[model samples]
Target: MTSKPAIGIFLSIALAASALWFWQTQTVRPAPAVSFKTIKGNSLELASLKGRPVIVSFWATDCPGCIEEIPHLISLHQQYKSSGLAIIAVSMYYDPPNHVLAIADSKQLPYEVALDPSGTLAQAFGNVQLTPTTFLIDKSGHIILQKVGVFELSDMQQRIEQL
Candidate 1:
């Protein structure tokens, strides 16, 4: 008769093997271009944002993570703008234009924020459910990173530095 220990070992080995297989097959991915109108009431082009690293940060007014990271994003903008880092703060829910302006001002966020007036663009890009999701597009406009939730300021800077 087999002992329970043998079964446990077999299960553990199987789990490990499957986990490894899954890890090798799947990873974070970038998105193809999706369209949206600009808050300025003009045609904002996604193509224009290519050939550099663009951070499309998805947020809603009520998300604490969204609110907390504005300052970090502001720093990222200031630090990396001249170095080809483009940050587009995309709102997942519509707030009044004036309110957005005020929050941006208070946070000292000088980056370009295109309001997703209906939050549809968030779905169009990727991961519609996650607030404060940051998509990092590489020099060729292919997505290289999609970070859900708040991330360290230094980590963002480090990645940009490498780029």
Candidate 2:
């Protein structure tokens, strides 16, 4: 019973609504403001790295998956540092700071290594309850991706290249 003009108006409204919904859902969000102290007593702040892409990794010393990702992260850091990529590996609260420090030293980790003794960093990042959870924040501070486990090197590289 609707006239042609009325049908066109309805369709236009629906299309506009759909486009708004898509934009709201697809837009990346800014990373949470969190800070941590590196094992060597250096301060690292998420907000401070706004102009560079950052990879924030939550890990524990005893986690097998976490251990598995270290080399890949190190390699990624080495490969992307010149391209303005910063990686911060934050040890979980359950991990003793000394252990984290020793491992960082032994492995000669070139990137910043931090200790989350109170788990504040993890809690801020959506109560991250799993080891190996990683957030890839783009140069503008928006969270480009979040991975719950080991990050595939190739996939991560492709994502980074896009940023």
Candidate 3:
């Protein structure tokens, strides 16, 4: 049988290992390179936005959460454009181009809207499989935050303010 002190030390080591693993998973890394055409037929490359903070949001028209987040994104774009914040909304492969275009037009989205029909863009961004998966990239083109699902507007604002 193990002594009491030995058991306690083992447990502490295991706990420390688990915490290290979790922290590594949560830490943001470099944003992947991606090039795609926007709804307006303009060529947009991730590298082009290197000098500005960019929010690359993967969304689809049929996703309620994605739809709900658009207004907040638009507001962010308006408030931060002058400060060099660029927002790029990328529609998923399953979403039809026409549907994406229609929604973009209706919403009057004030940022670049692109379609990832081949799933290349999604794969580049860590195989993003869920709608509303968003990445906040810093001016140096490194990902600072990767959030799945709806993100709180106030929290996002605070993060941007720091960048």
In terms of TM-score, the best-performing candidate is: 3
Q: What is candidate 1's lDDT per residue for 1-163, written digit by digit as tens?
A: 4779899999999999887555423324555566645555556666777778888888777789999898889888888899888888887665676777677667767777778776678767754677888877778776766677896788778877867
- Give the Å error, residue 34, model 1: 3.3
Residue 75 displacement (Å), model 2: 0.7
How far is 47's C-alpha from truth in model 3 (Å)?
1.0
lDDT scores for all predictions? Answer: 0.74, 0.87, 0.89
lDDT of 2: 0.87
Question: Which stretches of candidate 3 lie above 4 Å from their native place?
Answer: 1-25
Ordered by TM-score, highest first, the candidates read: 3, 2, 1
The model with the greater lDDT, 1 or 3, is: 3
Candidates in descending lDDT order: 3, 2, 1
Against the true structure, candidate 3 reaches a TM-score of: 0.84
Total colliding residue pairs, candidate 1 = 0
TM-score of each: 0.75, 0.82, 0.84
- Pairs that collide, model 2: none
**Residue 88 lDDT, candidate 2, scale 0-100:** 94
lDDT of 1: 0.74
Query: Residue 66 lDDT in model 3?
Result: 99
